[model samples]
Target: MPPRPRARTYDPAKTRAAVTAQLEHVRDAVRGLGEEQLAAPTRLGDWTVRELVAHLSMAVGAVGRHLERPAPPAPEVTATGWVAATAALGGDIDDDTRSLAASAAPAELLDRAAARFAELLPQAPGDRLLAARVGAMRLDDFLVTRCVELVVHTDDLAAALGTTLPYDRQALATATRLLADALAAKAPGGSVEVRVPPYAVVQCVEGPRHTRGTPPNVVETAPLTWIRLATGRLDWSEAVEEADVTASGERADLAPHLPLLA
Candidate 1:
């Protein structure tokens, strides 16, 4: 693997708070979902609304499950590493999420997951190492991943339900920053500056570096649009075509480097 980039530092308290707030946002929305709505299709290919919610529970619940295991001697993965590693587990994740969704009502599963996560997360230290499938990762780092999960899936859930869902500000910010930083790590360089105003600004893509004044290449977009592009929910070319993203230089085209977290 490429040399691990310096990982971003996250406030453990803020991360935990963001996770809790976002999970509750999903819980509140799903509590009123009827069978018809629960059976609705989501953008995640075959997963229904029920399966997606179950997967969200699993995403949060994984932390507790790993914490219950013996702690690892050292963290084998950084937060950025976790981003690229997730795609490999797609098959297993799909199987487990489907199984869990079938085993209980969506509301009940979400409640239990929320309670379990709340109980275990508060007791665990930020440096505690988790026995994650991708590899051992720190509690704080893993929690940051959970923010991505909650924010991204909450959007998926909202899209499936054809209604807008409230997003926890901290949760959205953390998720956006993490993915933005991941993109920089994936394409390490100082040739391009990507700005997601108010949330993140990262330099990436290898070429002649800029040291002073304005960068030669700059790409700017909103937080949600950035999230969508990074996660493959939105296409880069389409975003540019629709003027959703502003690109001003030759190296500003990020199409080849997008969907960084597939």
Candidate 2:
């Protein structure tokens, strides 16, 4: 596997709006859920709906706080690398999320956090590089990560309530591209082409070179399914059984390199 690549170019204006729009989508869905629904269990291990909401709020809040400090002299990690490296901070993150969840009602907590985030957003410049503990990353890059957080957690919320929520296209696109890029970084090779149609397609894994038309090895899935696979929400065999994923060619089986984050 090769090191993660620098972030793909993002339109700061579009990305900012994408983050807010995606959050509003989640918030709207969250508001319609009853109290009992909020107490249900999410697919994230033992995390309940309430804890998931609190964590989403934390993802948005981190940006505001990082913008409060000075940018680092240089980034320690690339944008795609951030996804895989997140588990490194898992312990403290879980503790903080649980603490936040315990301190207040989910609705009220997310409301206040959203309000705080909105107030600080306009004051932040797109070029500003936030001094995040994971690494120093641009404000726009941070917003892209928020899209992943919003999309993934929203899925958790829906799974908990036995319902499905509509995903904002731009949010889904951003999340798909980021994760796709991460996979290419983790398993660097051009022998296989992994496609998430209409969103992203990345070549990865080491094997025979295919420089011409019709690559020999390929894996394909929709954006949501790809996200679930990357995050460990769904297993390789389960996806195959459900027909959510389609793999072909000898090098296409990726079960050996999965659940990038524990």
**Best lDDT among the predictions, by candidate number:** 1
TM-score of 2: 0.94
Instruction: Mark the regions of model 2 whose C-alpha exceeds 4 Å error after superposition.
Output: 1-7
* Tens digits of lDDT, candidate 1, 82-191: 89999889999999999999999999998998888878877788999998989999898999999999999998998999999999999999999999888988898888
lDDT by residue for model 2 (1-262), tens: 5433454776777777888888887778777667788778887778889888889888887877787677888766656778888978988989999999999877777777688788999988876788876888777778888888888888877888888888888889988898888888888878899999999988888887678999999899999999998888889999988889999998999888787655
TM-score for every candidate vs. truth?
0.97, 0.94
Model 1 residue 75 lDDT? 88
Task: State residue 237's C-alpha deviation in candidate 1, in Å.
Answer: 0.6
lDDT of 2 at 81: 70
Candidate 1: lDDT over CA atoms?
0.90
